[model samples]
Target: MAGFGWATHSAHKHSANRHHLRTKARMDAGFRQMNGNLERKGSLTSSYLEEPLNKTGVVSCIFSLKQEVGALVKALRLFEEKGINLTHIESRPSRNNKEEYEFFISVDQLSSKALDEVVDGLRTQISGQVHELSRNKQKDTVPWFPNDIQDLDRFANQILSYGSELDADHPGFTDPVYRARRKEFADIAYNYRHAQVIPRVEYTAEEKYCGYREDNIPQLEDISHYLQTCTGFRLRPVAGLLSSRDFLAGLAFRVFHSTQYIRHSSKPMYTPEPDICHELLGHVPLFADPSFAQFSQEIGLASLGAPDEFIEKLATVYWFTVEFGLCKEGNEVKAYGAGLLSSFGELQYCLTDKPKLLPFEPEKTCQQKYPITEFQPVYYVAESFEDAKEKVRKFASIIPRPFSVRYNAYTQRIEVLDNTQQLKNLADSISGEISILCTALRKME
Candidate 1:
């Protein structure tokens, strides 16, 4: 599905209230002294010093201080002396040592050299061990990936809520009643649990103007149960649009993160983002079909550890296939994509010759671009859901991950077949299942 808005939102920011007692001259002297010492040690490189101040990114580091009365203050003073901005800070008792306290600090706008200096200072002066927390593409630094279905809870607050704080161009931006209604929906999603039944929405008549039946706003749990039975796909409420990585990761576990809020009542047929109408009326039916479900999961699985460029490609493929796709039914082309199905006007326009229609090939579809603020000018037509699934499976084989992963439903975990022992375990498990099937067949014979 197209994202609400493709803006990156960082939940962490520098607090304005944080104060430093060190003067500018003192901090500058400290910075120069630290740089000179590091240079003498061959640790601080000249290239790092040439980088612009604005080029810095957020970096988190953890260190533990001795139980001395002023140990925490002394460690913090190291940052103040170097003029580094501490965006966030937290403290907890060290698990390994009761007398020590572990401190986690997120530093904002610090260059690589500056961070290294801070780490060195912390280790040499106040703390013996200092480690930098990282989220990068390296094997050792790759961000955490969800292994089980319940792991999705961590991403609940990780999304950008376009509905809660409406953009100026959004239809409900100035409507007090509409904003309040949206907040009500946002609260439901915020408090939702993994396995709990979804609360039924009593959508107003205006909210039902999207051409769905008056009583068609079924509870998410009902749709989730139906999808589970048909294709093992289930639904979970989301505050708003998740990052492409998080959204596709959910699909890997056969879970769909759906928005609980509906579009502004003033513009029922047109919405700037995905709402309950788009999710249920447009997307739910296809998810119930086994072939399409498999097709969807193929895209999701390929996204694991994928590069940013490839993620954009995968998202585009999702946009063309799952969101605004069309398929042949007998001799007529029918609307199957959620975007087209949800919007009454777009639904009618896409089936007509108003938009360009092309065969749904993953290679071409991934490269095709579409506008988000307006109706899609191009749509991909699939021969059938089964055909789409087979093509996607072939396409997924080429994704550049060094290891392959499979979901173990029995254990509710993703098993990475990167080691010999893991492969052997998987092989033995499969062999036992095959043996059981053989016994049943022999008994029947």
Candidate 2:
């Protein structure tokens, strides 16, 4: 929900307001001309113009630069000479070569002919395997994450088939309700014990992980149990119809996909808002992993009393990592983020040779922009769970908050480290409520 500041790569665009205005004027005129052509020559229009131009007004280019020191400078010079305004440029470790880097660049849009010429030039001067992702624009529509349990069940058979096709193991096979749902999907739940995409747990975390998955279609009670058993986080359900909370008491799963809110009937995969599917499928899976739970709680804890600016940064980090993050498993990149996991279209598209994959760096990850309406144009890939947690810790520490937090798994309380007795006492009061709620929640098991 935070607005991210992107550093422009073009020196001209950074300082020259005149140049920026000129570019805008040219783009507007081009759009107008194209629109007029469509209206005047409706029957005789070219098939090429029939394809909608990218209204995002940006083009992403991924290319490898020669290892030479001057390679980047030469590439920049080419863009400058062509009057191509670049919004962003960053380099990441190439998948194949350690010595070289894959440069991801975003530039202002140009006409099709001009864009084609730029791609040709980059391929000739830069690496031969330059990839320009599909620039085709989708018809604008309201985006949502599926939330309804009943609605999700409508695709149970389809999901089961897809899971079997991928040889995926369904979580929560032990519960009768889960087994019943699995039966509807031809017993896809009992196909395997667990998913290979998740990290392997040692003997210590194994018991708690299994306990978290006791119920396949978890209720608020089940989720509360999972949170306490696995992560020591609490689940606080909302009371009223209209609510202002993004997350309840800094950590609860705020239900956004209920009957009260708007729902998408025609587009099964698309949700106009975050649904229960996004919470259960997208988020809860990672909670089963201990280290990931700690990382997530740290973000939640940091958000408790932080300033709006720092909270925004925390939100950005959460968005990129917890919501849309990918991690490397052996030689493969797998999605663990709820946003990617819940959306079938994006789940497959992300792993394909489509979106740009960059190594997980907290600084860069938080700064990158994402598209919610279409397939993500870029994703940050983590080396491992430990790597992600360490990076998150480093980033969290830099947040300019006045207090520190510590969670007691034994008492199910969050303790605040602060100078003010008033604030400390306030935190203690909340911790007491959490302790009581957690005790009752655990009893549901």
Candidate 3:
């Protein structure tokens, strides 16, 4: 809603309706082309104009076209003529020109002369402008942002599986038996689907490294259900480490991406990275507390579309608070951070005078640097979870983003509040809920 400008109701309604019409027309044409191809080929596989070439790499091209019937199909026909194999295709309404749509296609890489010919043909023939997106530009582009919960499947292979490529200094780097067991856990996580019952793991004696008794090791499904009931937080299995942006985005949807593997037995009480021990003993319990869950989600919401520098700052804030934070328990400081709770050595060491303890301040805490593989030299202590949440909420207000987003529970989708219609729809839903509450109160009286 940040960039929206005030406009007359009639003008706003007209614009919204026009936009809807254009979207519907584009979809209709796409469906018609698909159906025609299906009818001709009699199957989806045979519908391709050319078989994929034995190319070593892929190339992405983007083009824009004025709104016209059969325009998209005509462009596809050009690719067929050039014997170019399209691997993927997507289209979106152009932001710069409302009268046109931008099309993105990934095709098998071609020689410079052939690629230039294809581009020239499109420019002179169907599409007015066509350009190949450079690979470096693709990497620098905005990271893929998920709009739906199921889109998380895209990150399944985002990291190495089972720590198979662990550093030489890692405790499990040379332990084949430990690495084999990790692969088993990784397999389970890889096949997991959204909304499916979470698979349970029976931890071996050596795997219970988080100081929890064997009987106290709750099943992942049970913890997921408890968190869902108490604070709308649930868990999904992750392969391994995620980029800070991807991990924080899961919080926006009240989802936590947890690892299934246990740490190496050699270092039962310590781990270089998060494993099931850290997830269960340190993170799961705090998520059941509503105040802490809200605080966690606030950090996540602030990361969405934030600039790279701000993302680094937010990751630092998370490192200090969620990973290694402390809280005042009346007169004593208690460990609340997952890193402190999961590591026996750090848990006791943090409470001692050896480490510097400072009051939690988002402004300063985000700037403090700490060690990753060793005990934290500094810890930020908050008075209460609620206090931390409020401080973080204020801190998030200054993050630079063009629009605000809200998670719509009913649809399970993130609604970008960038238009008048979206605001009106949210207001109507709230009013209806308030009316229901008032009626119930009156009846009780």
RMSD of each: 13.3, 23.7, 14.6
Q: How do these models rank on lDDT, best leading?
A: 1, 3, 2
- Taking the tens digit of each residue's C-alpha lDDT, what string does model 2 give over 1-445? 0011111111111112111111223312322233322123231111012222456666555666657778888777777777777786766665334456667676665643355656677678765345333244322111111112122121112210111121122233234453333233333222212111111112223222323245333454455466656655433222111111123113422212111111122232343233334455666667767787767656655554343345445656766677678998998888887766666666777789988989989877767655433556888899988898888778878766434555444433344443244355557778999999999999998
Query: Per-candidate TM vs. native?
Result: 0.66, 0.43, 0.66
- Which one wins by TM-score: 2 or 3? 3
**Model 1 stretches with alpha carbons more than 4 Å out:** 1-136, 139-141, 204-211, 329-332, 429-445
lDDT per residue for candidate 1 within 1-445, as digits (tens), equals 3232220011111111111111223212222233222113322111011111222365555577778888888887888888888887877775435567777666764344576677778877764445224322322222235666676675554554363777787778899988988888888887887888888888777777654565656778888999999999999988766666667778888888888777676655456666666688778888998888888888887776555566667777887888777888899889887766656667777778788989999988888755544556788999988888888877777776555677776665566554455678789999999999999999999
Backbone clashes in model 1: 0
- Which ten contiguous residues of candidate 3 have the minimum total lDDT? 1-10
User: Which runs in model 3 stand beyond 4 Å of their true positions?
Assistant: 1-142, 160-162, 202-211, 215-217, 329-332, 433-445
* C-alpha lDDT of residue 253 in model 3: 80
The prediction achieving the highest lDDT against the true structure is 1
- Model 1 / residue 204 / CA error / Å: 4.4
> Would you give me the overall lDDT of model 2?
0.46
What are the lDDT scores of the predictions, listed in order? 0.65, 0.46, 0.63
